[model samples]
Target: MLAHIGGRGFPPDEAAERAWATALWERTGGRPSGAPVARQIDAIRASGDRTAELRRITAPTLVVHGDRDLLVHPSGGRATAAAIPGARHVEIAGMGHHLAPGVLDRLVDLTTALARTHGARPATTPTPTPAPAPPTEEPA
Candidate 1:
């Protein structure tokens, strides 16, 4: 089912498959469900104009889209990035809805680099621990 939906990036490595399967199972109790057809139709109809909302996002945004994604077309990603102010768009070649095993590190690197470039600082100091409270003296 994942393969049919995800298209080109299906049949991920065994470890990834197991991990994702476990996560999905835990999240949904293995009884996967999607929005109702009516709701989906309504959402599609209402999604026509979101430029104003997109423009209001002030935080640093990274829009990473896979060229081969079948669930959501690549143009949607492009449009999202274009609408958001200063949103960096990255279109990975040959990637689909599901990322290839090798692409994980690249995605992480891209995210880290973007955060660094946008002046987002990583936590340098460890959280200070509080000292233990002194024991109360027992009255005789």
Candidate 2:
């Protein structure tokens, strides 16, 4: 499962892989658990083609995929972008299905730029209403 999600050249660091495996093992009560992994595989298999629905999307869409992604190939991203109207596709080189160091920041920046370009406004906190003016004291 890790290999499928992380790609063949994933981790790039044996220590990182060991740490991840240890954490996963701890999370799974130290027993070799395959339920979650099986579920992910099943989900992928069950997901039917949604190209028609994808083409119907009118909102500004961004399809970002790792060029080295093994689970979902870059072609999938290209096809998704092609299907959506005016969708932008970004292929990051040397990245895989798993999040690599510093990739999240790049993704955030890309999304932020896209949102800015598309005039997406950040949620604003509503200004608090001023307290009702204290009742004026009656003149003697």
Candidate 3:
């Protein structure tokens, strides 16, 4: 689960807002009316308790956050990671509000490694093993 943001997850500019808004409005079973959208936003803000909801989740989760995310705000990500029990949080610096534009391969390597491993532990020194002594029996 690669929860990436701060790059391509949001619209690149104001021009795409209409389409984005329309899709979101339609998905919520409401027509794309201005007042309805405003109401939806307000209702979302007034929602109730969710600890039971969060705890009901059964699958593994990944929480990725950008240190300088200006859109969704870093607090939301932090709270989200905290709310989900046992969720892993990863923070990257200088990754703005779009996650798909720059350094894709590097991002892939990072996210993949994150999802797969808990990161490299400091290497432990190998203990030296003593070699066994050979035949002194030939001298007898």
lDDT of each: 0.83, 0.83, 0.63
Best by lDDT: 1
Which candidate model has the greater TM-score, 1 or 3?
1
* Candidate 1 vs. true structure, TM-score: 0.68
Model 2 Cα lDDT, one tens digit per residue, 1-140: 55556654435455777898899899878999778879999998898898999989998899989888877878999999999999999988767898755477788999999999999999999999999988889899
lDDT of 3 by residue, 66-97 (tens): 66676568776777777887876666665555
Q: Which portions of model 3 show Cα errors greater than 4 Å?
A: 1-51, 114-140
Question: What are the TM-scores, per candidate, against the unseen true structure?
Answer: 0.68, 0.73, 0.45
Q: What is the Cα-based lDDT of residue 85 in candidate 1?
A: 94
Error (Å) of candidate 2 at residue 34 is 1.3
At residue 128, candidate 1 shows an lDDT of: 88
lDDT by residue (60-133, candidate 1, tens digit) is: 99999988788799998999999999999999876778776767887999999999998989879988899999
> Which has the greatest TM-score?
2
